[model samples]
Target: MCGIVGYLGKHDTKAILLDGLKELEYRGYDSAGIAVLQAEEFSYFKAVGKLANLEAKTADFTTSGFAAGIGHTRWATHGKPTEINAHPHLGDASYVVHNGIIENYQELKNALISEGAHFLSQTDTEVIVHLFESLLNGGLKPFDAFRETVSRLKGAYAILLVTKQMPETIFFAKHGSPMIVGVNESDEKFFGSSDAALIGKCHRVIYLEDGQLGFVSRTGIHLEDAHAAAVVPHFASLPESKLSAQKEGFRFFMEKEIYEQSEVLSDTLIGRLAEDAILFDELNPSLLEGINEIKLCACGTSYHAALASSYLFERLGKIRTSVEIASELRYKEPLLCTDTLFVVISQSGETADTLETLKMAKAAGLKTLVVCNVDNSSMVREADAAILTRAGIEKGVASTKAFATQMAVLWMFSLYVAQTKDTIDAETLRKQIGLLREVPAVVRVHDDLHERIRRLSKRYLHGHGFFFIGRDIFFPLALEGALKLKEISYLHAEGYPSGEMKHGPIALADPELFTIALMPKNLLYDKTKSNVEELSARDATICAISDVPFEKADDFIPIAAHDHYMLEFFETMVVLQLLSMEIAIRLGNDVDMPRNLAKSVTVE
Candidate 1:
């Protein structure tokens, strides 16, 4: 993933572009670049590191009298993180910055080379700008040339181009990646990879849909489809203060997001729960009645959430359920059941693999439901029905609030389906719904363990590797915990079912190894405890996160037991998140912007 920002207005173009790039640095930080047009000439500056390096190199450019500019923060998909591979790549007559991968870049590059075009950078974005220059040289109008170039392109991209030929205007397009147009009170036009980049600079924003091309000038912004059909733009207001708030006393965004899980979970379940029932008016029970099975698809953290949902859907809804990783599902010849309902889950809603899978599911004649946080994401627009998680802007690369909110939504939906099928009586449903409301209160107690978790992190941070063990629904939580640790802390961690430990993972256990055992005292507690004993016998350090203390564990985190599955799940998740955050902090790593990672995976 990468971040793109541009401006077409009277303000200092350099200041606006640089500030926008810094705001979006969380999306990516490997490399940064900016291109500005002053007196109809392009001035470029780039650096290979954090945004601070770019800032250090562009001190004079910020004061230059530029009319329009574009900037980028790259995560390095096509090439190594070097200044040459940084964005704002040059063509014969223009500069372009891009987000998302260009799948057919090699073929396009060969075609351009045959046409006598020279490339300066090892990036797919360079091929695109050169193509634009070739079309302009072929005697096409600027708008028509952009349209044709996009038509020939394949794979995901959100591109922003500013040509010397059209010195006062900025042209842009999106296929699978996200792009937004923002207009301030002064009618200044701003472009960004996400709305977060436009905050404080512009409030009124328009989300650019896939397969759309547009241009912004001092006069106004105009949009059209790939076929040149005119498209009307719809704008929504985003409050700057709410989105751009300062981290109040928190060391990092990950820590704040981990603590925000409770409030976000409450917000996610707000209107959907009642005294004795859960309501999802968007989900037609009649459709669920007709479908014999359910198939859930997602990627990364969302995939773990989907795995957790499959257990809930089968046990509570009394339906056969299967889970698939979106990336793998797209390439395989999956058995498409006409009677199976497909549910796609994503936090950004623009996950490329998941979106492609959603399209495939729709084409196969299966009814689809999407669970997403962003309201108008491509997945939400294409699905038959959608459930919004309402988890606000998650800036941390490792998701915390978003994942918990997704679990809350999944649990609510599962119970709703079960109630509709009469599998769960009214009284049982009421008790579950009541326990859901108390999750926020129970989660608050996790802060008491912060000091203890920090101590455990100090003890285990130097271990060779870590293993996370749980069973049933907890197995998915185990995977999520390991993912969080590996993403931020850069630790070598693996998650496995407790029963499977003896099969293969047990061999990796030694005194240098660290293991986090989730023995939640649930139905499978005894089975999981047996695995923990095996690890203890091997002298591997064990940190048991449970409702009750275990004498054999090297460290113990005690959470009060709950009969309801959701409450116990939420409590354990909070503690595990704290552990990861503390470990990453202790290791002196960038907790918010992890290495070779981005907040959203727009590229496959």
Candidate 2:
């Protein structure tokens, strides 16, 4: 994955594009660059290894006065993250910044080579620039050149292009990757891979749909279909508050997001409860009748959310449930029937594997529902029905708030299904919904855990081994916590059911290892505590996360004590998120953007 930003305005083009790239650093990159048109020529600067390297190289340049530009921070997909491979990829007449893969680039490149085209970098993006140059040299207009070039291409792409011939305007198109155009009051325009990159700069934004192209200028933005039919843009305010983008004295976005969980969770639950304590109002009545089984398809952290959902669906809805990683679901070829309901979960809604999995289920004529953060991502668009998780912009590559909101939404959805199926008694459903409603307030009590987590970070900073163990619902929480640590912290963390420790994982336990015991105050509390005791006896330093106090633990992180289900299902997860951030920071890692990872996996 890569980050792309473009600007067309009165401000210094270089300054605006560079600032936008900085905002997108959390998308993860090893190289960055910008292309600005000045003095009737393209001026470019690029460097390998972080945006700061490019910034340092361009420190002496006057960024002001340029009218239009495009910038990119790249996560290498087809080539090494080298300075030459970074965008704005320059051609004879046009410069381009791209976000997705060009799957047939090799074939295109071979054809171009036969036509005597010279290549510089080993990137699929370079093929696009050369193709544009070829088309433009053949007398096609800039827009026409882009149109023809895209017509020949296959695979996901969100491209921003600027030409020396059309100095006042920028052209953009989206096929699969996410791109949005933001318009300010003065008619100046901004476009980026995510809305967060353009947040305060523009109050109004138009999300470009797949296969849509637009010409943006200081006067306004004009959108068109692939066939050049004029179209109106649908605008919306940026989902996140302006302040949420600011650190607000916090060192990182991860830390700030961790602290914002209570408010985020509360907002997610707003209007979710009905007079009878049913969770959601948007279920298909027919699907709720005689549901035979439930299948959840998700990837990465969302898979963990699904695992948590499986626990709740079985317990609260009294239904058979299975959680399958989206990438593995097709190969496994698990039985699917008309009576089976499939739930697809994704933070971006554009995750390539998850979307493909959802399509497969929909093709099978199964009832499909999507739980997603983005309003109209591919998965959401393809699903029969969907629930939006209003988690706002999660720019950080290592997810914090999104995971919490996913869990919250899943819990509510489970409760709703339970009510519709008449599996849960009315009073019991009411009590569960009541507890769900109180989660935000309970999360508020432990909001100060960040500092405590930071203090313990050094212990796990160089730790190569980590074990996460929990019982019942906490098992998924444990798995998710370990996944977070491994994702960003680069720790070798494994999550196991507490009861399964003696099965094998305990053999890895030693003084050099760290064990995070998710000992929630639940029915399995004693079993989890015994697992912690077993780790402690093996000379492992135990970090006990629970509402119940433990005597032999090295560290006790207390959560607000609540009913067994709520405690196991909700509060403990928050602490694991904090710990993931703290450990990442201690390792001198960029917790927001882990290396070699992208915020959204748009390419398969």
lDDT of 2 by residue, 253-303 (tens): 777777788899888999887756755656567766656789999998999
> Model 1, 1-604: lDDT tens per residue?
7999999887788888888887789888999999988789888999998999999998866544438889999998887999999999998778889898888889999999999998878888888898988999999998778888888889899999999888989999998999989999998899998777888888899888889998988788889988789999999886777442346678998888877777777788888898889988777767675788889999999999999988989888888899999999999999888798899999988898999999999999999999999887889988999999998888888998889888888889889878877788778788878888887777763555787788877887786999998899999999999999999999999988988988988898888889899988765788889889998998988999988789999989888878765677888898889898898998999999999899878888
Give candidate 2's whole-model lDDT.
0.82
Best by lDDT: 1
Go through the candidates in order and give each one's C-alpha lDDT.
Answer: 0.87, 0.82
lDDT of candidate 2 at residue 128, scale 0 to 100: 89
- Highest TM-score scorer: 1
Tell me the spans in candidate 2 whose CA falls farther than 4 Å from its real position: 63-66, 217-222, 227-230, 239-241, 279-291, 330-336, 445-454, 462-464
* Clash pairs (backbone) in predicted model 1: none
- Count backbone overlaps in model 2: 0
Q: In angstroms, how far off is 2's CA in candidate 2?
A: 1.6
Candidate 2, after superposition: displacement of residue 355 in Å? 2.4
TM-score: model 1 vs. ground truth:
0.97
Model 2 residue pairs with clashes: none
